[model samples]
Target: MKAMILAAGLGTRLRPLTLDRPKPLVDVHGRPLIEYNLLLLRRYGIVDVIINLHHQGDALRAALGSGDTLGVRIVYSPEDPLLDTGGAIKNAASLLGDDDFLVLNGDTIIDLPLDALLAAHRARRAAATLVLRHDPEQQRYGLVEIDGEERIRRFLGRPAEVETALVPYMFAGVHVLSSRVLDYMPDPGTTFSITRATYPAMLAADEGLYGFPFAGFWRVIDTAADLARANAILEERPPLHFL
Candidate 1:
């Protein structure tokens, strides 16, 4: 399957570490953070990759040229003015082709079972399946509430209807989306967020947007403290299986 890594963010929270290099290139235990993500995707047999680049985009392109040495074919979707999540994916639509594809946020690290997630997506016949986790601080992030069957009944920390009882779960920065889902997205140049715009729209339309709940090791490197914590975790439990 094809995959897209959203590596174009400014990473303002990363500060000095990102001042010299992009957040994807920031070292998280010896290797660049995005390298670990690429390696994990490679292990899952995702060979074709499209990475969106901005804020030192050229440097990232240079470092990961073609991804040949790493055994994956790399393609770039360079953004002159970086688009948000939905926009980036829409901009890369041609490269992604017309099929179901996986999207990953480059700053997050998670040990997700690809096969299971994909199977769940297919079985539920969902337009998109977001990987989710139970976090009490769901309000802080864009949260989703799933029904017994994992269909997202609520989004963005809001209840969809009167009958729906919201069950709190935070988005895990990973998604399996069908190409048809793009039809609901705004124009490529429009500043839209998949979490904020597309998914909510889908929910309102009664489309089957589900959540794949996974209880695994996951972290998002949004700030210096998060980076340090990821380094500590990697040092304590180096993921050999990922390699």
Candidate 2:
């Protein structure tokens, strides 16, 4: 299987730490944040990966090299002006191939059953299956509204009408996407967001956009406080299985 780590963000939220390096290279629990995702991908038997680079792109390249140390073959997609999630994935379309592939946020640490997520995606034959979790701050983090059937009905705020009692779920920054989802990608070389652009359109068309609710360990290292919390969590409960 193949996967792509979205590592091209400027990491403005991380401040001075990211001022010197990219978010993917930001240290979390004594290791680069992106490394956790790399290890997770390896555990799932995914050996081929693509990583988008921007905001200290060279540093990220130097840090990860050819992904040899992690046991995965990595090809880089360099964005001159950082493309958002949607554009980044579209930029690497050639490498991702014409099949389902995994996409993970570079700065998140998650230990969910990726194999089961893959199975669910295949069973539903969804255009995109996002990994979501119940978060009290879901609305604050731009909640994803899903129906009882687990189909994603809206993201952030869309449809502008409430028909059913939608459950608020936060995007876990991990998703399994069919190559066909690329069809909804914005024009090449354009900056776009999957959540702000692609997802809403797909939902409007009634495409099979599903969500897998995960009740497991997940964290996004976006700030100093978040980093500290992550370190504390790891200290209390070592991620021996994930690491």
Best by lDDT: 1
Each candidate: RMSD to true structure? 2.4, 2.1
Show the colliding residue pairs in model 1: none
* Model 2, runs deviating above 4 Å: 157-164
Clashes of each: 0, 0
Candidate 2 per-residue lDDT, tens place, 1-243, comes to 789999998898889999999999888888889999998889878979999998999999998899999898899999988788899999999889998999998888998788899999999989999999986555545468888889897886432234446567888899999988999987768898898889889888889999999988888887898899999998899574657
> Candidate 2, TM-score vs. the true structure?
0.94
Would you list the C-alpha lDDT of every candidate in the order shown? 0.88, 0.87
**Model 2 alpha-carbon miss at residue 162, Å:** 8.3
Candidate 2 local distance difference test against the native: 0.87
Residue 51, candidate 2: C-alpha displacement in angstroms? 0.5
What candidate 1 gets wrong by more than 4 Å, as runs, is 157-165, 238-240
Error of 1 at 12 (Å): 0.4
In model 1, how large is the Cα lDDT of residue 18? 90
